[model samples]
Target: MWRQVALEAFPDAGIREPIGASALAEAELRLGRSLPTELKQLLLESNGVIGRTHVDTVWTVDQIVEQNLFFWSDESLARLYMSFDAFLFFGDNGGGDQFAFVQKPERADVFVWEHESDSRRWVANDLRDYLGRSLSAGGDDWYQ
Candidate 1:
Protein backbone atom coordinates (compact mmCIF):
# COMPACT_ATOMS: atom_id res chain seq x y z
CA MET A 1 0.00 0.00 0.00
CA TRP A 2 2.76 2.38 1.00
CA ARG A 3 4.76 1.49 -2.09
CA GLN A 4 1.82 2.31 -4.28
CA VAL A 5 1.35 5.59 -2.51
CA ALA A 6 5.00 6.44 -2.90
CA LEU A 7 4.84 5.64 -6.56
CA GLU A 8 1.91 7.96 -7.04
CA ALA A 9 3.14 10.69 -4.73
CA PHE A 10 6.78 10.53 -5.71
CA PRO A 11 7.11 8.56 -8.84
CA ASP A 12 10.73 9.62 -9.01
CA ALA A 13 11.49 9.08 -5.30
CA GLY A 14 12.12 5.88 -3.37
CA ILE A 15 10.12 4.51 -0.41
CA ARG A 16 11.55 2.85 2.69
CA GLU A 17 10.60 0.68 5.68
CA PRO A 18 9.06 1.75 9.00
CA ILE A 19 11.34 2.68 11.88
CA GLY A 20 11.96 0.39 14.87
CA ALA A 21 10.24 0.36 18.31
CA SER A 22 13.15 1.29 20.53
CA ALA A 23 13.80 4.26 18.32
CA LEU A 24 10.12 5.11 18.48
CA ALA A 25 10.19 4.96 22.29
CA GLU A 26 13.23 7.17 22.35
CA ALA A 27 11.56 9.60 19.99
CA GLU A 28 8.43 9.53 22.14
CA LEU A 29 10.49 10.33 25.22
CA ARG A 30 12.20 13.15 23.40
CA LEU A 31 8.88 14.50 22.09
CA GLY A 32 6.87 13.88 25.33
CA ARG A 33 3.91 12.50 23.45
CA SER A 34 2.81 8.92 23.76
CA LEU A 35 2.09 7.54 20.33
CA PRO A 36 -1.42 6.38 19.60
CA THR A 37 -1.78 2.60 20.06
CA GLU A 38 -3.26 2.01 16.64
CA LEU A 39 -0.45 3.86 14.91
CA LYS A 40 2.14 1.97 16.89
CA GLN A 41 0.57 -1.31 15.90
CA LEU A 42 0.62 -0.41 12.23
CA LEU A 43 4.29 0.51 12.32
CA LEU A 44 5.11 -2.66 14.19
CA GLU A 45 3.13 -4.75 11.75
CA SER A 46 4.54 -3.05 8.71
CA ASN A 47 8.09 -3.63 10.07
CA GLY A 48 9.71 -2.32 6.91
CA VAL A 49 8.90 0.34 4.35
CA ILE A 50 5.20 1.16 4.18
CA GLY A 51 5.48 2.97 0.87
CA ARG A 52 6.69 2.51 -2.71
CA THR A 53 10.28 2.68 -3.98
CA HIS A 54 12.52 1.91 -6.89
CA VAL A 55 15.35 0.78 -4.62
CA ASP A 56 14.82 -1.44 -1.59
CA THR A 57 15.00 0.76 1.50
CA VAL A 58 14.74 0.00 5.18
CA TRP A 59 13.67 2.72 7.64
CA THR A 60 15.11 2.08 11.05
CA VAL A 61 14.81 4.38 14.05
CA ASP A 62 18.59 4.59 14.17
CA GLN A 63 18.62 5.77 10.58
CA ILE A 64 16.10 8.46 11.44
CA VAL A 65 18.28 9.55 14.36
CA GLU A 66 21.42 9.45 12.26
CA GLN A 67 19.64 11.56 9.69
CA ASN A 68 18.45 13.93 12.47
CA LEU A 69 14.78 13.94 11.52
CA PHE A 70 13.36 14.86 14.91
CA PHE A 71 9.79 15.72 15.71
CA TRP A 72 8.69 19.32 16.09
CA SER A 73 7.69 20.46 19.59
CA ASP A 74 4.99 22.86 18.52
CA GLU A 75 1.70 21.09 17.86
CA SER A 76 0.82 23.55 15.13
CA LEU A 77 4.12 23.02 13.41
CA ALA A 78 3.82 19.30 13.62
CA ARG A 79 0.27 19.46 12.38
CA LEU A 80 1.26 21.59 9.44
CA TYR A 81 4.09 19.30 8.40
CA MET A 82 2.01 16.16 8.82
CA SER A 83 -0.90 17.72 7.05
CA PHE A 84 1.29 18.45 4.08
CA ASP A 85 3.29 15.24 4.12
CA ALA A 86 1.01 12.46 5.35
CA PHE A 87 -2.66 13.43 5.68
CA LEU A 88 -3.11 15.48 2.53
CA PHE A 89 -1.91 12.66 0.32
CA PHE A 90 -3.86 9.96 2.14
CA GLY A 91 -7.04 11.96 2.22
CA ASP A 92 -9.76 11.53 4.88
CA ASN A 93 -11.14 8.18 3.99
CA GLY A 94 -13.01 6.10 6.59
CA GLY A 95 -10.03 3.83 7.34
CA GLY A 96 -7.92 5.74 9.87
CA ASP A 97 -6.44 9.08 10.81
CA GLN A 98 -2.68 9.75 10.93
CA PHE A 99 -0.89 12.53 12.74
CA ALA A 100 2.69 13.63 13.40
CA PHE A 101 4.33 14.74 16.66
CA VAL A 102 7.78 15.56 17.91
CA GLN A 103 9.76 14.16 20.79
CA LYS A 104 10.31 16.72 23.57
CA PRO A 105 14.01 17.08 24.27
CA GLU A 106 15.31 15.46 21.11
CA ARG A 107 12.58 17.00 19.00
CA ALA A 108 12.44 14.04 16.68
CA ASP A 109 9.48 13.90 14.31
CA VAL A 110 7.15 10.94 14.78
CA PHE A 111 4.18 9.90 12.69
CA VAL A 112 1.08 8.21 14.08
CA TRP A 113 -1.96 6.95 12.19
CA GLU A 114 -5.00 5.97 14.19
CA HIS A 115 -6.66 2.83 12.81
CA GLU A 116 -10.08 3.49 14.27
CA SER A 117 -12.13 6.67 14.11
CA ASP A 118 -15.21 7.81 16.04
CA SER A 119 -16.91 8.87 12.83
CA ARG A 120 -15.85 5.71 11.07
CA ARG A 121 -13.70 7.71 8.71
CA TRP A 122 -10.69 5.97 7.27
CA VAL A 123 -7.71 8.24 6.91
CA ALA A 124 -4.95 6.05 5.47
CA ASN A 125 -6.41 3.06 3.73
CA ASP A 126 -4.49 3.86 0.58
CA LEU A 127 -1.01 3.49 2.04
CA ARG A 128 0.48 3.77 -1.44
CA ASP A 129 -1.20 7.07 -2.23
CA TYR A 130 -0.43 8.63 1.14
CA LEU A 131 3.19 7.51 1.23
CA GLY A 132 3.75 8.30 -2.42
CA ARG A 133 2.51 11.85 -2.03
CA SER A 134 4.25 12.36 1.31
CA LEU A 135 7.55 11.05 0.01
CA SER A 136 7.30 12.88 -3.26
CA ALA A 137 7.64 16.22 -1.53
CA GLY A 138 11.33 15.84 -0.64
CA GLY A 139 10.71 13.13 1.97
CA ASP A 140 13.19 10.89 0.17
CA ASP A 141 15.87 13.44 0.98
CA TRP A 142 14.73 13.70 4.63
CA TYR A 143 17.54 11.47 5.89
CA GLN A 144 20.14 13.26 3.86
Candidate 2:
Protein backbone atom coordinates (compact mmCIF):
# COMPACT_ATOMS: atom_id res chain seq x y z
CA MET A 1 0.00 0.00 0.00
CA TRP A 2 2.81 2.39 0.84
CA ARG A 3 4.58 1.62 -2.42
CA GLN A 4 1.32 2.00 -4.29
CA VAL A 5 0.64 5.34 -2.67
CA ALA A 6 4.10 6.60 -3.54
CA LEU A 7 3.95 5.32 -7.10
CA GLU A 8 0.59 6.98 -7.57
CA ALA A 9 2.16 10.31 -6.67
CA PHE A 10 5.41 9.89 -8.59
CA PRO A 11 5.59 7.04 -11.04
CA ASP A 12 9.33 6.76 -10.61
CA ALA A 13 9.35 6.99 -6.82
CA GLY A 14 12.04 4.77 -5.35
CA ILE A 15 11.09 2.43 -2.55
CA ARG A 16 13.71 0.76 -0.37
CA GLU A 17 13.79 -2.32 1.81
CA PRO A 18 11.94 -1.89 5.07
CA ILE A 19 13.87 -1.70 8.29
CA GLY A 20 13.21 -4.17 11.12
CA ALA A 21 11.28 -3.60 14.31
CA SER A 22 14.48 -3.39 16.25
CA ALA A 23 15.70 -0.57 14.08
CA LEU A 24 12.48 1.30 14.69
CA ALA A 25 12.80 0.79 18.42
CA GLU A 26 16.38 2.02 18.35
CA ALA A 27 15.39 5.04 16.31
CA GLU A 28 12.72 5.98 18.83
CA LEU A 29 15.03 5.22 21.76
CA ARG A 30 17.85 7.32 20.39
CA LEU A 31 15.59 10.14 19.37
CA GLY A 32 14.07 9.90 22.85
CA ARG A 33 10.58 10.10 21.42
CA SER A 34 8.11 7.85 19.71
CA LEU A 35 7.74 8.43 16.00
CA PRO A 36 4.36 9.53 14.76
CA THR A 37 2.28 6.37 14.15
CA GLU A 38 1.86 6.98 10.43
CA LEU A 39 5.56 7.55 10.02
CA LYS A 40 6.44 4.37 11.88
CA GLN A 41 4.11 2.36 9.65
CA LEU A 42 5.49 4.03 6.54
CA LEU A 43 9.07 3.30 7.58
CA LEU A 44 8.16 -0.31 8.16
CA GLU A 45 6.73 -0.38 4.65
CA SER A 46 9.85 1.22 3.13
CA ASN A 47 12.92 2.44 4.92
CA GLY A 48 12.95 5.44 2.66
CA VAL A 49 11.20 7.01 -0.27
CA ILE A 50 13.25 8.74 -2.93
CA GLY A 51 11.38 11.26 -5.05
CA ARG A 52 12.05 13.66 -7.90
CA THR A 53 15.64 14.58 -8.76
CA HIS A 54 16.94 11.86 -6.43
CA VAL A 55 15.84 13.67 -3.35
CA ASP A 56 15.36 11.86 -0.04
CA THR A 57 11.62 12.36 0.21
CA VAL A 58 11.68 10.07 3.23
CA TRP A 59 15.00 9.15 4.79
CA THR A 60 16.12 5.82 6.17
CA VAL A 61 15.98 5.10 9.89
CA ASP A 62 19.70 5.68 10.33
CA GLN A 63 19.62 9.01 8.55
CA ILE A 64 16.57 10.03 10.55
CA VAL A 65 18.33 9.25 13.83
CA GLU A 66 21.59 10.95 12.82
CA GLN A 67 19.97 14.08 11.41
CA ASN A 68 17.63 14.61 14.36
CA LEU A 69 20.41 14.03 16.87
CA PHE A 70 22.65 16.51 15.09
CA PHE A 71 19.92 19.12 14.85
CA TRP A 72 18.92 18.67 18.45
CA SER A 73 22.41 18.69 19.92
CA ASP A 74 24.63 20.88 17.76
CA GLU A 75 25.75 23.87 19.80
CA SER A 76 26.55 25.99 16.77
CA LEU A 77 23.10 25.28 15.41
CA ALA A 78 21.65 26.16 18.79
CA ARG A 79 23.32 29.53 18.70
CA LEU A 80 22.47 30.23 15.10
CA TYR A 81 18.80 29.30 15.02
CA MET A 82 15.71 28.55 17.02
CA SER A 83 15.56 25.35 18.96
CA PHE A 84 15.23 22.10 17.00
CA ASP A 85 13.91 20.21 19.99
CA ALA A 86 10.35 20.69 18.85
CA PHE A 87 10.87 19.00 15.50
CA LEU A 88 12.01 15.61 14.25
CA PHE A 89 13.68 15.90 10.84
CA PHE A 90 13.42 12.93 8.49
CA GLY A 91 14.12 14.09 4.92
CA ASP A 92 15.78 16.72 2.77
CA ASN A 93 14.83 18.73 -0.32
CA GLY A 94 18.02 17.74 -2.23
CA GLY A 95 19.31 21.13 -1.44
CA GLY A 96 19.37 22.02 2.27
CA ASP A 97 15.75 22.45 3.34
CA GLN A 98 14.39 19.56 5.38
CA PHE A 99 11.04 17.94 6.19
CA ALA A 100 9.97 17.21 9.74
CA PHE A 101 7.14 16.21 12.02
CA VAL A 102 6.13 18.24 15.03
CA GLN A 103 7.20 16.06 17.92
CA LYS A 104 6.57 18.57 20.65
CA PRO A 105 2.89 19.06 20.04
CA GLU A 106 2.74 15.57 18.61
CA ARG A 107 0.78 16.47 15.52
CA ALA A 108 0.55 14.66 12.20
CA ASP A 109 1.27 17.74 10.14
CA VAL A 110 4.54 17.87 8.22
CA PHE A 111 6.54 21.06 8.01
CA VAL A 112 9.50 22.28 6.05
CA TRP A 113 12.50 23.60 7.90
CA GLU A 114 13.99 26.22 5.63
CA HIS A 115 17.66 25.80 6.49
CA GLU A 116 18.78 29.26 5.50
CA SER A 117 16.44 31.21 7.73
CA ASP A 118 15.70 28.48 10.29
CA SER A 119 12.03 28.85 9.62
CA ARG A 120 9.46 26.14 10.13
CA ARG A 121 6.29 26.30 8.06
CA TRP A 122 3.44 23.84 7.51
CA VAL A 123 3.46 22.18 4.11
CA ALA A 124 1.18 19.19 4.40
CA ASN A 125 -1.51 17.92 6.73
CA ASP A 126 0.00 14.50 7.34
CA LEU A 127 2.51 11.98 6.07
CA ARG A 128 0.36 10.80 3.17
CA ASP A 129 -0.44 14.34 2.19
CA TYR A 130 3.24 15.12 2.34
CA LEU A 131 4.16 12.21 0.10
CA GLY A 132 1.51 13.25 -2.41
CA ARG A 133 2.51 16.90 -2.49
CA SER A 134 6.26 16.43 -2.51
CA LEU A 135 6.41 13.50 -4.88
CA SER A 136 3.95 14.82 -7.47
CA ALA A 137 5.14 18.42 -7.45
CA GLY A 138 8.34 17.23 -9.23
CA GLY A 139 10.41 20.12 -8.01
CA ASP A 140 12.86 20.66 -5.19
CA ASP A 141 11.03 23.69 -3.89
CA TRP A 142 7.60 22.14 -3.94
CA TYR A 143 6.58 23.69 -0.64
CA GLN A 144 7.62 27.11 -1.84
Candidate 3:
Protein backbone atom coordinates (compact mmCIF):
# COMPACT_ATOMS: atom_id res chain seq x y z
CA MET A 1 0.00 0.00 0.00
CA TRP A 2 2.81 2.40 0.82
CA ARG A 3 4.57 1.64 -2.45
CA GLN A 4 1.35 2.16 -4.35
CA VAL A 5 0.83 5.50 -2.66
CA ALA A 6 4.37 6.61 -3.42
CA LEU A 7 4.03 5.62 -7.04
CA GLU A 8 0.67 7.28 -7.47
CA ALA A 9 1.40 10.40 -5.51
CA PHE A 10 4.84 11.15 -6.87
CA PRO A 11 5.08 8.71 -9.78
CA ASP A 12 8.74 9.58 -10.08
CA ALA A 13 9.53 9.10 -6.44
CA GLY A 14 12.37 6.89 -5.26
CA ILE A 15 11.94 4.28 -2.53
CA ARG A 16 14.49 3.56 0.16
CA GLU A 17 14.90 0.13 1.66
CA PRO A 18 14.13 -0.26 5.34
CA ILE A 19 16.62 1.27 7.69
CA GLY A 20 18.25 -1.07 10.21
CA ALA A 21 17.31 -1.42 13.87
CA SER A 22 20.32 0.61 15.02
CA ALA A 23 19.30 3.52 12.86
CA LEU A 24 15.72 3.18 13.97
CA ALA A 25 16.89 3.31 17.57
CA GLU A 26 18.80 6.48 16.87
CA ALA A 27 15.76 7.97 15.23
CA GLU A 28 13.61 7.04 18.19
CA LEU A 29 16.06 8.79 20.45
CA ARG A 30 15.80 11.92 18.35
CA LEU A 31 12.05 11.78 18.08
CA GLY A 32 11.46 11.19 21.78
CA ARG A 33 8.68 8.67 21.14
CA SER A 34 8.84 4.96 20.91
CA LEU A 35 7.58 4.17 17.42
CA PRO A 36 4.71 1.75 17.57
CA THR A 37 5.99 -1.79 17.21
CA GLU A 38 3.81 -2.47 14.20
CA LEU A 39 4.99 0.68 12.51
CA LYS A 40 8.59 -0.23 13.23
CA GLN A 41 8.03 -3.69 11.85
CA LEU A 42 6.41 -2.28 8.74
CA LEU A 43 9.36 0.00 8.13
CA LEU A 44 11.81 -2.79 8.77
CA GLU A 45 10.10 -5.16 6.37
CA SER A 46 9.48 -2.79 3.47
CA ASN A 47 10.89 0.02 1.39
CA GLY A 48 9.37 2.47 3.81
CA VAL A 49 10.92 5.81 2.95
CA ILE A 50 9.49 7.45 -0.18
CA GLY A 51 10.52 10.72 -1.79
CA ARG A 52 11.40 12.39 -5.05
CA THR A 53 15.02 11.99 -6.08
CA HIS A 54 15.21 15.63 -7.01
CA VAL A 55 13.58 16.98 -3.90
CA ASP A 56 15.02 17.26 -0.40
CA THR A 57 12.91 15.07 1.88
CA VAL A 58 13.50 13.82 5.40
CA TRP A 59 11.79 10.89 7.09
CA THR A 60 12.91 10.96 10.71
CA VAL A 61 10.94 12.86 13.32
CA ASP A 62 14.15 14.56 14.33
CA GLN A 63 14.79 15.68 10.79
CA ILE A 64 11.25 16.96 10.61
CA VAL A 65 11.84 18.94 13.79
CA GLU A 66 15.30 20.18 12.81
CA GLN A 67 13.70 21.42 9.64
CA ASN A 68 10.93 22.91 11.74
CA LEU A 69 8.42 20.52 10.18
CA PHE A 70 7.29 18.93 13.46
CA PHE A 71 3.76 19.72 12.44
CA TRP A 72 4.36 17.12 9.77
CA SER A 73 5.95 14.58 12.11
CA ASP A 74 2.92 12.56 13.15
CA GLU A 75 1.99 9.48 11.18
CA SER A 76 -1.08 11.06 9.59
CA LEU A 77 0.85 14.21 8.86
CA ALA A 78 3.57 12.06 7.33
CA ARG A 79 0.99 10.65 4.94
CA LEU A 80 0.20 14.17 3.81
CA TYR A 81 3.90 14.78 3.25
CA MET A 82 4.01 11.63 1.19
CA SER A 83 0.92 12.34 -0.93
CA PHE A 84 0.43 16.08 -1.14
CA ASP A 85 2.30 18.99 -2.67
CA ALA A 86 2.51 21.21 0.43
CA PHE A 87 1.45 21.32 4.09
CA LEU A 88 1.75 23.19 7.39
CA PHE A 89 0.95 22.37 10.99
CA PHE A 90 -2.24 23.70 12.44
CA GLY A 91 -2.65 24.33 16.13
CA ASP A 92 -3.29 21.30 18.24
CA ASN A 93 -6.77 20.49 19.52
CA GLY A 94 -6.53 18.89 22.94
CA GLY A 95 -7.81 15.34 23.42
CA GLY A 96 -5.20 14.32 20.83
CA ASP A 97 -6.71 15.74 17.64
CA GLN A 98 -3.80 17.52 15.98
CA PHE A 99 -4.09 18.90 12.46
CA ALA A 100 -1.36 19.34 9.90
CA PHE A 101 0.25 22.68 9.29
CA VAL A 102 -0.36 23.35 5.59
CA GLN A 103 1.00 25.95 3.26
CA LYS A 104 -2.25 25.96 1.33
CA PRO A 105 -5.17 25.45 3.66
CA GLU A 106 -7.37 24.41 0.73
CA ARG A 107 -5.23 21.36 0.11
CA ALA A 108 -5.26 20.47 3.79
CA ASP A 109 -9.02 20.96 3.77
CA VAL A 110 -9.41 17.78 1.76
CA PHE A 111 -7.78 15.41 4.26
CA VAL A 112 -11.05 14.23 5.73
CA TRP A 113 -12.67 14.34 2.28
CA GLU A 114 -10.21 11.92 0.72
CA HIS A 115 -10.32 9.63 3.74
CA GLU A 116 -13.47 9.24 5.82
CA SER A 117 -13.55 9.92 9.55
CA ASP A 118 -13.00 6.30 10.46
CA SER A 119 -10.38 6.06 7.75
CA ARG A 120 -8.34 8.80 9.41
CA ARG A 121 -9.11 7.70 12.92
CA TRP A 122 -6.24 5.23 13.27
CA VAL A 123 -2.62 5.40 12.14
CA ALA A 124 -1.92 2.01 10.60
CA ASN A 125 -5.41 1.50 9.20
CA ASP A 126 -5.57 5.07 7.95
CA LEU A 127 -2.14 4.83 6.32
CA ARG A 128 -3.16 1.69 4.48
CA ASP A 129 -6.38 3.19 3.18
CA TYR A 130 -4.70 6.44 2.24
CA LEU A 131 -2.19 4.61 0.10
CA GLY A 132 -4.86 2.35 -1.34
CA ARG A 133 -7.02 5.30 -2.37
CA SER A 134 -4.10 7.18 -3.84
CA LEU A 135 -3.21 4.23 -6.02
CA SER A 136 -6.80 3.37 -6.86
CA ALA A 137 -7.65 6.94 -7.79
CA GLY A 138 -4.64 7.19 -10.06
CA GLY A 139 -5.67 3.91 -11.69
CA ASP A 140 -3.65 2.06 -14.35
CA ASP A 141 -2.30 5.36 -15.50
CA TRP A 142 -0.14 5.30 -12.40
CA TYR A 143 1.41 1.84 -12.61
CA GLN A 144 3.27 2.21 -15.86
Predicted structure with the largest TM-score when compared to the true one? 2
Q: What is the lDDT of residue 105 in candidate 1?
A: 31
For model 3, residues 10-96, the per-residue Cα lDDT tens digits are 666555666688876876676454554534554564434333333222133333334333443456756654442243222111223
TM-score of each: 0.31, 0.97, 0.39
TM-score of model 2 vs. true structure:
0.97
* Model 3, residue pairs in steric clash: 87-102, 88-101, 88-102, 89-100, 89-101, 90-100, 90-101
lDDT of 1 by residue, 1-144 (tens): 434434555565433455578867985575344544534544554433433333223233443333233322346545544322222111111223333332233222344344332112222233333354345545333321
Judge candidate 2 at residue 74 and give its lDDT: 96
Give per-model CA RMSD: 11.5, 0.7, 11.6
Once superposed on the true structure, which residue ranges of model 1 sit more than 4 Å away at CA?
36-144
Per-candidate clash tally = 34, 0, 7
- How accurate locally, in lDDT, is each candidate? 0.38, 0.92, 0.39
Model 1 shows how many backbone clashes?
A: 34
Ranking by lDDT: 2, 3, 1
Task: Give the winner by lDDT.
Answer: 2
Against the true structure, candidate 3 reaches a TM-score of 0.39
